[model samples]
Target: MTRHQTSNNRAVLRTAAVPARKTLGGGGAAFLAALLLLSCSNPSGPKRNEAKIQGVVYRNDTRTPVPGATIVLERPVSVATAGEGGSYSMAFTADTTYITNVIATMPGFRSDTEQVVVVPQKTSTVDLYLRADTSSPVTPSQSGDAANIYLVDFTPEFISVSGTGANDVAKLTFQVRDAHGTPVDSAHGVTVAFSITNGPSRGEYIFPSSAPTDPRTGKVTVSLNAGTKSGVVQILATAQVGTKMIGSEPVRMTIFGGLPDQAHFSIAPQMYNFPGLDWLNRTDQIMVLVGDKYSNPVQPRTAVYFETAGGVVDASGYTDAAGLAGVTLRSGNPIGNDPVYGPGFAYLKARTVGENGATVKDSILILFSGFPTEMTLSPSSFNLPVGDQAGEVFTYRIADRFGHPMAEGAAVNVTSDGAPVVLSGDVNLEFPDTQSSSWTTFHFKVNRKESDPGAKSGNVAINIKVTGQNGNRSISLTGYVAY
Candidate 1:
């Protein structure tokens, strides 16, 4: 029997239509209202000073701790970082009343906030459950026992309609289900049809649009050609189930045309040093934002072209749903007079053709600040007699991120431990000191006569450290001397 017939027979056999439905719906509404009100209301009696706050943050669906979430407390504001187990704690002083407000936040997850009353010498715990952001255009799930079909999702929600036919296709995916709200695997081999419900007549679902659902998944895929015109296209899906046909409610997608209204551009870690010895592992990211005149993010997967000078970049790509596109740029070798140990610049440009065939463009100047990243000893190992003055133990070198020697005169401090080896020269020596002309080296000697012979037979550790003028980075080198 059809679903409607089954419902009718049940209704007539029992009293389920008027009184039962109305009574249950009314009770449910009232209960939900009360619950919501109670949750939003604050407690009235609160006067305690020695209270403690602690809680764990969990993913709403998985019930697992959300490590790295940040929790903040108001009123003499304080913050704490959640531990690996997603637990955090904060203490409030005794003798002061506090209606503490607690908030927890993490990127890509909805933040949770709550207010609790603190009583003297008591512990108030508040556990937070965070929901993942589901702000995408497509969401799929069954509601009730209904024989309905719908577009679960259509990838690339927006399309840039160029005059060419090859660039106008969008993939449309949908599902078929039975009246019981379960995917109808039996519906496999059943043909599903696609059509553009709202768009210029030029738009069409490509041939073979009437394809059978997959035998295992009850899903179907088809291609729709967005017409040359720019506007919103509503794609609809339908399939026949049993003797009756079910139609999927239509979903809307967009096609862009005309001059783009806006463009945004930025570079990640705008300041970085060129990776001299390690180019493959270091890179900067460039992000571009393209939008229509209305400032709405452009269509997903809209191709954008990138051009850069003074760097290497993976520049060709498309913008995502948020109208954002990203490319990685690795700093090229420092050129000309730009110091490899100082600041340098690279230029990047992003451009995309709007529907009107006009170029929408933006550019950014990526600044790279170079700093010393490595310290090395010409002779890494050293050995000394227990009672002798050693000369020029080893030449220490300082290099920037690009492996280029820093300017001469960089000052460094040396220290020794375990076996007090007396530094024979100045404690602070200029890099590549007067003894050598190299811009990055320093030579120093050690007098080990004062080293206590009983201490591991006068084994000593010599340490050399240097800090740049800007304090952006500090580099240190350690060498061990053994008798």
Candidate 2:
């Protein structure tokens, strides 16, 4: 009876407070009320800070640190490079990840690249192993020490072969013998691939030398039965390194197709060859047409592959459509007439193609005999600044009696005031005036001796000589100076 009376009294109190009370709804109301109680009792905790990351890079093969190697943190953000102990340290926030690259670079050692990742507050370790570098120099790139490996029925030096068309197959064979020319059972280790450039594509067209090894005679077949460029090309065996340079000897073969089309172009007799036209003097408007058997007009962007073991080509063109497509030919015209190249045996090749992109004309072959062309500097003179060394500016052009820009990268012999300098230098430079596909003009920064503070100015002469395969140079020059 007392408990019932007390509950009735509480109900009376609730009814009395209803006029002054409001309601709070949902779990949010419960949370807010709890928060209020807590605020009256306890305080909130402190905030957390961002995380930090760090690490080191080492040599994988030797288990040693590879110092001086280039390292990159290639992720959320990048940090790089290890100091002297082959050790590196870097920092990052907790939530981010990073990629690290390590490159190996040491002489007589091969190079390599590696990757890694790092998370916040965590340290990552990445390392690398670099092998020694071993490759031949087709260009002026740095190469390692090498012993010669001579093969039979193959040219170790660059050679050329002709192809039927874009898809034509070209073949050549090399013997896998010892340095003494004795065939060895060595074909098993050969890995051959072709470096295809300047063709329809612009990278390696590899043909692995991994052919079936002969158990008996130890003879390996070095053949390029596929991926031969239609024009003149320098094909060589590219060897990969890990062990000795001795296995699977590298061989070179120059493959070419078609005969050179006999071509002739005209220039106003005075532009270059006027009464005093010195050799290598460029003409203004090379106004001659190329002679090919095709009834169709010469394709504007055809593969007019022009090259010279002798000199460079200048294709500074007037037309915007084709990037200056120039070639340097052997300067002299010792070339005689042949069925392939009617008169100019300058080894020029011209081909016609159908809509299907197939060779429409037979590859023409040009055979030029006799001493090659001469390269001479025009005005053969100059007055250079006393303090500031000025370059030698000259006008040079290539023609086959008729005129045209020679192929590209021609060998030109240049002399200072009559003294010999570089044998082969500079190719077709951009011409000066009218935007015609005619003659090319260029300024050669006349290399000068460090100007002596004592002498104010001096008179000198320069000669521009054209070179040939045999190292012979055709010389011409002008008044030179050093200020």
Tell me the whole-model lDDT of each prediction, alpha carbons only: 0.56, 0.35
Which candidate leads in lDDT? 1
- lDDT for model 1: 0.56
Determine the C-alpha RMSD for candidate 1 after optimal superposition of all C-alphas: 25.9
Worst 10 residues of 1 by lDDT: 11-20
In order of listing, the candidates' clash counts read 6, 70
The prediction achieving the highest TM-score against the true structure is 1
Q: Candidate 2 — which residues are off by over 4 angstroms?
A: 1-342, 345-362, 365-370, 385-392, 398-410, 417-443, 447-456, 478-482
TM-score of 1: 0.31
RMSD of each predicted structure: 25.9, 31.4
Cα lDDT of model 1 by residue, 365-433, tens digit: 554434567667656556665444544456676666544543334567877776555575545855431
TM-score of each: 0.31, 0.22
